[model samples]
Target: MQIVEDDIRVDELCTRREYARWLVRLNSLLERNPKHRIVPTISLSGSLAVAFDDISVDDPDFVYIQALAEAGIIPSKLSSTSLFSVTPEDGSFYFNPDRYLSRKDMINWRAQLEYAILPGTKEQMSRIRADYMDVKDISSDTSPEFFADMLTGEKSIIRKVFGQSRRFQPNKPSTKAQAAVTLTSGRMAEAVQHELLRMEAESSSRQAAAEEIKSELLVRGDIKNFWNEKLLVERNRGVEVQKLYIATLQDLDKEKNLQAQNLTENMKEKAAMDCQRHLILTLREEIEETSERLASERATYVAEQCNIQELRKAALMDQEGILDSKSILEAEVEALRILRTWVEDEAKKSQARAKVLEEVGRRWKWDNQA
Candidate 1:
């Protein structure tokens, strides 16, 4: 990960955002699709070679490597999670989604993660295979009409979710909207918080100590980095929880592609249109639970936005106060300058008076002596 480390300072503490990004990269490597292509790395002159849109030396594996000539960090400053903190007490590794950040001894972290995830992935695949094994049998023995009926039954539930999402998606401030984002956008608390901090720090009072610190942190890209990490952590948590289902979904996709070959043109078009709603996983607990969660999260988001507006208003008031203080300090400085000038004028007059008396005394002594 020293791709960016050559000129970056090692002693620089990782900002929360940087830490959060680190967590995602590390988790993405260990917990994501096993076959997801890792970004390629190239070395030249004992440093990472320049490249465009590829690779990060900040990755956990390479960040602490002693052989690289990049800026580094105190490895212990980071908090620990599953792979970093694993103990083979009973000989099985624990998977706590705790800190997800750091620990000192990281030489074998990848080994620890492999040890933890290997058995879980195998078990999950076995269960998924067992569940899907009957699909071919069910299709082969069924008549055409019976098979069509089965597809219709399952497709209707999917249609309901797809239709509902379509209905609500337009109501959102939808000049532009991403398909995967509509549902996840319901969790808007973090976005609201980001707006609040951004507004407050955009123009902070220089004389106000707290505001100065805020501005400095904002300038250094520290403030937003912290919040971004928190959001990434939440996203990664959801991703980790759903990790096992990824393999199942991959198998399901293959079956779907095979089944699609038999469909007519119109039916295929309809199927393609509904695929956008795949993110709306409203099964198991039913649609109502998803709706309720969305509503609750949306309400929380609105409340936070209101709070941000209030905070910005308060910040404006503080800025006004700082301006008033600036005017008062300026007036006091003018008065001090005037007083100093008057004192200098009086000292010059006293010096002139002393010189006159000295001249008079010297003349009187010369006349008495004559």
Candidate 2:
């Protein structure tokens, strides 16, 4: 089952028909080598069938095949087959398995492989023509140049599987030896990649476990600190509670002593108030008696004043009568004074008559003696 030639150069080129034949040979070589069990991402048989269907049903080919079949230039069996049964499931029947593979076919194979390996929902062949595809080196979308740039990009399936290359000539044909070497190289690269991914996954798991263990240890320390703080709080609370209990007992005893003192003072005050009440009642009664006595004495004094006023009026009338009698006595005294003055004149006349009679007796004695 020797598949690749020792003299197959990397730059050797062939036609699309020739490349298909080589691809079939590569798949056969991979199958016979049981030691390398790498599964191809794309089925070589399916890709060939699709190519055969395209060539058969295309406008020119269909017209040519119809013309040939109707004129009896070609077999009629192809007309009935009509590229209809070339489904993904039954494609191997149309294309000869030993046909040579073209660069276009290689692009299809690599793109399918990328679709299988990479992460995306859109199919790889469709993405090759999508506007977002960065294969700027490609000359035309309809030509084989487009797939050449797609397969030769930095992260392309061919670059990943077969290592980096300066160019991917999609129009160039592929030899059987070249196809075998590319397939073998791709399988080995995938194996090595799988191994590296497994090792990296294990390393990441170990790092995550270490981080988790560190986090648990930190949590344990925090728990210990929380309990220590809780113990201190409980101790302080106990001390405060004991102090509060003692203070409450002292306050209760003080309250009891104050209540007993208040009761004694209340009884003493009640007795004093009762005695004062009795004294006030006695004073009120005495005041009533004194008021009655004063009223009676005032009436008696009023009667005595009336009697004194009558005596004063009688004395004034008697003094007036005595004054009239004294005036009559003074008039009688004046009449007696006039009668005494007349008697004094008669005494003087009697004295003179005596003197005359004494003179006559002296003369008669003289006449008798002669």
Candidate 3:
């Protein structure tokens, strides 16, 4: 961390990087432990505001307080700063007495400033420096030379201080362009702002004239009666309007009821339509079943007709065969007659055998029997 030896002394200049780093560090330290913007003599705790305005700087109480503060006896909050430093979400920075003060007391701030003594006595100036630099009283020989001795002595470490380097090609190239744009934008808005201001001025004047007229009217006692009468008229009109509103609501209710009735009728019609549709569907199904039955019956009838035709054809073929062969038909008839005659002959033989009491019956040789 040590940059130089204790025994050695150099007159070489420090780099800008070192300076910048130290500067940034100092800024960070300040941010971490913020310094007071001002140290006030007055403090407010809740509703209670404690002020040192009653005591003058020459007073024993004021001197005693400063002594105690120097001795670290009095608290910094009570001795120097306010109870609170309100900023951002911290409320107002300046002291505003408007919260507790009345309209009559708002302008009366001279009382608080009655004992407002400017601290630290000023040394009489022998001559004024052209650059407004005050004559610094450097008394101690052992005291560190803050500026003059360090810059002038042969043991001076800083030989030169340089300004910012040429930034022809800057780190942020768009910065210049953006700054130009911002400036141009402001210039562009100037005319509009001027016009707006002129319009606002005219409006303000008109408002002021209206306010003046209103203020003048405040002197008239009759205006109160006029407003009261107007108010009464407005209230009566309001009552009539309310009655009309109620009548409108009643009409709306009636309309709703009518709509409801219509809706009910529509629902009934819809229900009837649905029932009719269902019945139509049922009838369609029945018709389809009947049609299917009829189709089956027709097929059966056609099938039966086909079978009857086949049977009739068979009958006609047999008749045709009989017509074609008439001799064969006569032969079959004669054979059937012979078979009947044989049965009759058997009956006669049985009777004859019965008459003889032991006669044997004769069988025909039709069975190939001998």
Query: Which candidate's lDDT is highest?
Result: 2
Q: Rate the local accuracy (lDDT) of all candidates.
A: 0.42, 0.52, 0.41
lDDT by residue (tens digit), candidate 1, 1-370: 1213345444443332343233334333333334321222321235533221122345444432211212111112121223124334444322221222221111112222222233355444334432122344332221222222223332322122233232222112211112112111211224435555766776454347787788999999998999899989989998986885897899899988877775666587777766745545445356888789989999999999999999999999999999999999989989888988888888887788778877888888888899
Candidate 2 RMSD to the real structure = 38.8
**How accurate locally is residue 294 in candidate 2, as Cα lDDT from 0 to 100?**
82
Q: In terms of TM-score, how similar is model 3 to the real structure?
A: 0.29
Candidate scoring better on TM-score of 1 and 3? 3
Determine the backbone clash count of candidate 1. 8
Please give the distance, in angstroms, between residue 359's alpha carbon in candidate 1 and its true position after superposition: 2.7
TM-score of model 2 relative to the true fold? 0.29
Ranked candidates, highest lDDT first = 2, 1, 3
